[model samples]
Target: MINQSVNEGKTAAIISHFWIIGLIIAFIMNMSKKNYFSSFYIRQMIGLNALQFLNGWIVYKFLGGTAGWIVGVLLFVLWIISLFGAIKSEEKLVPVVGEQFQNWFKNF
Candidate 1:
């Protein structure tokens, strides 16, 4: 049973990184089961998605140029790292803001 939950959690974690919709689905899925691993990744992905949205908005509204592209690439890299960590079933942090994200979203 524990192994099954872990497997489900891992699957949820991986799915959560797919995109905004995936994150929402995974969040709903985790709410019922409350798997720690899934919740952790869900929070991380939520933070990433929020950052991406904010960056896009700022770049479109103000910093319209190569700066936006650069930030987009950096965010993509961070997303990839988080996705790989989920694939490996590891609780690796997402980089600079990862720990803070975990702390902030602990209730999830």
Candidate 2:
């Protein structure tokens, strides 16, 4: 059963890593299936998207080029880590902010 859920959700989990559009698709897929594996990844993607907006847009707006670039790279690294986890069927969170994401998006 666990293996099946992981397999079923793996695609959605991977899809969730492709930024906004992928997140949307993964979310819709998971909505019907309601599997824990997909939900875990979807929630993480949503949180990453939020942070990307907050740090990318807002920070870039205020702090100018360099800070925004650095943060963007960091977020990209985090995204890579998250994507790898999804790919491996692992629930590893993306460092510092991962826990916060899980808590905030618990309902998803």
Candidate 3:
């Protein structure tokens, strides 16, 4: 049972840890078969990354380095938690933002 989920989307799941690489792998995998966690995690990570980038840029431009560092740390923690959940086959989301990801990325 566990092995089946791993075998079904293990590549995508593992790839997702690599940031962009995992995302691409998930996209490709989705083309053929659907792995629930892999697809959700991929989209979640992409959205998170985009938000982080935008926040960092805006903060750096306006608030400077200190604010950016704070936001970056928070995002890092979220990423780690999300990765852990996906690896464990748990559908847990990263605190507040995770549930939204699940809902938003349901189609994939």
Candidate 4:
């Protein structure tokens, strides 16, 4: 039973990294099961999604040049790394603001 719960949590964790929709689904899944693993990934994904949104606005609207593209690439790389971590069922904090994200979204 413990192993089954862990597997479920890992599955939810991995799914949470897909995108905003996946994040919501994972959030709901975790709510039902209350899995710490899924919660960790959910918080990270929330932070990542918020960052991506802000980055998009700043880059496209304010920057609108090579700088915007560069930021987009960097965000993509971060997303990939976070997704990989989730897939591996590891609580690897993302670079830079990962720890901050965990603290900020602790209630989630």
RMSD in Å for all candidates = 1.7, 0.8, 2.2, 1.8
Taken over the whole model, the C-alpha lDDT of each candidate is 0.88, 0.93, 0.74, 0.85
Residue 7 in model 2: lDDT: 96
Candidate 1 yields a Cα-based lDDT of 0.88
lDDT of 4 by residue, 23-86 (tens): 9889988886699888988999899889888888887788776887888788888889988887
Candidate 1, residue 20: CA error in Å? 1.1
Task: Give stretches of model 4 more than 4 Å off.
Answer: 1-5
The RMSD (Cα, Å) of candidate 3 is 2.2
The best candidate in terms of TM-score: 2
Candidate 3 per-residue lDDT over residues 64-83, each given as its tens digit: 99888888888888888878
Which tens-of-lDDT digit does each residue in 1-108 have in candidate 1? 766666779988999998988998898888877998899899899889988998889985698868888888999999999999988878879999999999888888
Instruction: For residues 1-108, write the lDDT of model 2, one tens digit per residue.
Output: 999989999999999999899999999998876999999999899999998999967889999889999999999999999999998999989899999999999999
Go through the candidates in order and give the clash count of each.
0, 0, 2, 0
- Descending-lDDT candidate ranking: 2, 1, 4, 3
Candidate 2 deviant stretches above 4 angstroms: none
lDDT of model 3 at position 12: 78
Which residues of candidate 1, in runs, are more than 4 Å off?
A: 1-5
Winner on lDDT (2 vs 4) = 2
TM-scores, one per candidate: 0.91, 0.96, 0.81, 0.89
